[model samples]
Target: MKASAAMRTALQRQWQEGGWLSWLLFPFSLLAAAAVAAKRLAYRAGWRRAERVGVPVVVVGNLYVGGTGKTPFIVAAAHALRERGHRPGIVSRGYGAAIGPVPRVGCGTLDPAVFGDEPALIARQAGVPVAVHPRRAEAARTLLHQHPDVDVILSDDGLQHLALARDVEIVVQDERGIGNGLLLPAGPLREPASRLRGVDAVVTNRSGGRDGTLPTPPAGVRAVDMDLVIDSVWRLADGERRPLPALPAARRIAAVAGIGNPARFFATLRRAGIRLDATVGLPDHYDYAHSPFAAIEADLILVTDKDAVKCPAPDDPRVWAVSVSAHLSDPTFFDWLETRLHGRTPA
Candidate 1:
């Protein structure tokens, strides 16, 4: 991992538990919490009006700051909505990218660096048009203008972005389930645990382990589990689909992930019975401007679908990308979600 990634990983470790470092940072978290509360109050009091893009918006986001598998859930939701006869388009803030206010539409052929890693992954996997901008509401407007057939918009990571008015709000959580329950600089949350109470639904993701049970939801909060099952594996050098077991019985096999939760990818591979020689976790949205595993002696380097977009095609053939599909614990979850879109059903 790069130096910046290492430092971030270290901080995330501190966020999972209370320590002197977290306590020292607790005062700063209060300042952030106060700012968030104030902004929310402004919106709630009508001091600031949220803009709508003339389409029903469904925002899928997390309170854990990052991870929690929001991108996979977005892709899954888009596919499910299409099957239910609703045309869906996706909008994102294009975080970690230098894109300006102007919206950038995305496709599988788009450059991940120019757009965003998550957007690129959604475009490639979900087969939906994606519009990215700093302001998600603007992206939604641009997406609707470009794809007039779309009657519903999915906002990737827009729970905190109150500028975009959403008809349905869904918060995705992982096994950690609000560690230490503190706000930023102290814990992982962008919003407090109370935020989940207002969301249309809460989704607990089994991103790290397949058989692993989901984190228990807070009392009175209804939550559902989401399983991300590995659907297939694709070779990076060439877009060839191969089963996990088919990956050459090489002498040394390793995995490297730059997503929010690298351990999830590692476990998915292990569950598939792939023996890994080593595992490397980098910061989320790790740009593959240069291959970090270039010098590794492994015969194959396993990567996740999100990280694969950055390495759509790598010079080295050892790199491979694993694809996963989000499966809700209960099929009825889609029934509930579809009900939310009923009023905005496409004419």
Candidate 2:
């Protein structure tokens, strides 16, 4: 395994199943917790002002530091709003990009390498305006400047970014919930589990409920369930819609996922009855600058949509991107959100 991947595995083990390493790192987490608390306090006490971008901002964020179906959820929510006659724009912190203070803003097919994978995916899939920068508030302003009709903004995973003032906060949690429920460096939680109590809505991704029910959420918080179903597979070379069952039942099939939780992608394909000969799970937000596909030998290759954005082998006919969409248990979640959002004065 690569050194970084090995370290990530080790840390995941430590975070999920506490050990001596997690305990050894607990002190550092305490310091991080202190800093996070102080920073949030500064915002709350008016020491640091949060800038609102003259629109109703709904932050689809995370408490856990990994995948929770936030990207697909944001795309799905954007579609839902557009269907309801509300124009929505998106803003992100461009997690894996090398951008500066100035925000990169645009619509249509954007370069994931320049704008970040998730934002690019949102732009392409939602066909809505998207802007990305380290400062999400700045990105929001830029997006609004270009798309002045945007009535709402769906922020991609900025729960801790207090500077980007939001009207509604929605936390997306996967089956892992909060690993070990400790702060950064010691556990997977970016914020305390108590953070859920204050959010406007909680989205549980694939809660694994047999009867299509989710666990009880924190008191008074509206909750919904999200499951990403493999919608279809498209050719990276020609953007052909190759259905899963139709993809030649012959040949060695290998799936590659460069996502926060790759196992989920592999399992989704498996459940879709795709007989794969191999699965390559890369690190979250993995840059394809060094294409793994060059070395992966397979007659057919499948990749997650998030990874597809930054894939270097778009011309390789052997590779295809799996298109997945979020299936919400309660469709009314958007209606509930829209009502609240419309209650506020949108920019």
Candidate 3:
């Protein structure tokens, strides 16, 4: 069932409060959890073989079913890998896109609607080869075949897809850490919190917070803190770029975030010292074909880079996109990630 605005807000509250509604749905969570465990066990017991696509695969995913800065993290990680002498290509499920048998995504190829917003945005921002298919393994293979020099495969949100064997797994979490701690239809988690213990690394995207430290992870698991640096805002009309401070103080603003955690986006704007008259949290990967901006009272509209890609050039010049980049606190995570991707320990 599509979550209503009230339901989405209630779920967000439940993540923090663990209210009665979450308790009421707990029975179903158990059934969902058991099924999830059995599927993983099948892969572990060799009942299902994980397909390896010749190159090392690094998966960036989240245990919770929402945005956890995976898009920005992958863009940052991909460039960092490139700097360390590895070519990275991306593979995604291309949710909400109509990717046919030919699933390759690049310049002069599929439109955002046809290729999916995330895949299209990744290709545009990362400037690397990307492919989208419901079957990620097929996407990865097609991506590799097209970009043969690609040394590493970065799987976007493929932790549950055990069909694709991965050498390194990095699970990212945002401010809404394991809300309600229950399985889908009840709470936010796709896997149990204990799943953190098995992954190679856990990254906390504390971009919304002011403090230096990330929220603590489970016991025995080392956590890396990441910040999303809001670099600039670009005019959606003429592609005119301006520093964040360039936002006109005269106009009232509305921060519109269609991401998994819209509050985080609003917090980002607040941290940037831009006070919003209104904050709108649309569903994740919201199609902006019919924008809600018309009803918004604010004179200016600000959106995330992800939303910016899907939103067509607004007729109004007041609309702008805030572009952000991920900054990981621990340099060692990359070194560790590099070693795992190469399957070699540094001398």
Of the candidates shown, which would achieve the greatest lDDT relative to the real structure? 2
The Cα error of candidate 2 at residue 285, in Å, is 1.3
Model 2 residue runs over 4 Å out of place are 207-216, 344-347
Q: What's the count of clashing pairs in each model shown?
A: 0, 1, 0
Write model 3 residue lDDT over 1-347, tens digit each, in one string.
Answer: 23577778877788656888888888999999999999999998999999999999998999879898999999988888998998989999998887788766564334678788888888888878888998888888888888899999999999988899998888999867776677876788898888888887888888877443334676655578888988999988888998998876646888888888888899888887888888888999999877777787877899998888878656878789999998889877777788776678632
Query: TM-score for every candidate vs. truth?
Result: 0.93, 0.94, 0.94
Residue 176, model 2, lDDT:
71
Candidate 3 scores a C-alpha RMSD against the true structure in Å of 2.4
Full-model lDDT for every candidate = 0.83, 0.85, 0.84
Report clash pairs, candidate 2: 54-347
Q: Give candidate 3's total backbone clashes.
A: 0
Q: State, as a TM-score between 0 and 1, how close model 2 is to the true structure.
A: 0.94
- Candidate 1: regions farther than 4 A off: 2-6, 210-222, 343-347
Ranking by lDDT: 2, 3, 1
Give per-residue CA lDDT, model 1, range 1-347, as digits (tens).
46876787678778876788899999999998999999999999999999977878998989997788898899889988899898989998887788985899866666777788888878888899999998888888888888899999999998999999998888888877787789998888898888887887888887675444334565654478888887878888878998766767688999998878888778878877888998888877778776777677899888888888776455688888888888887777776777767754321
State, as a TM-score between 0 and 1, how close model 1 is to the true structure. 0.93
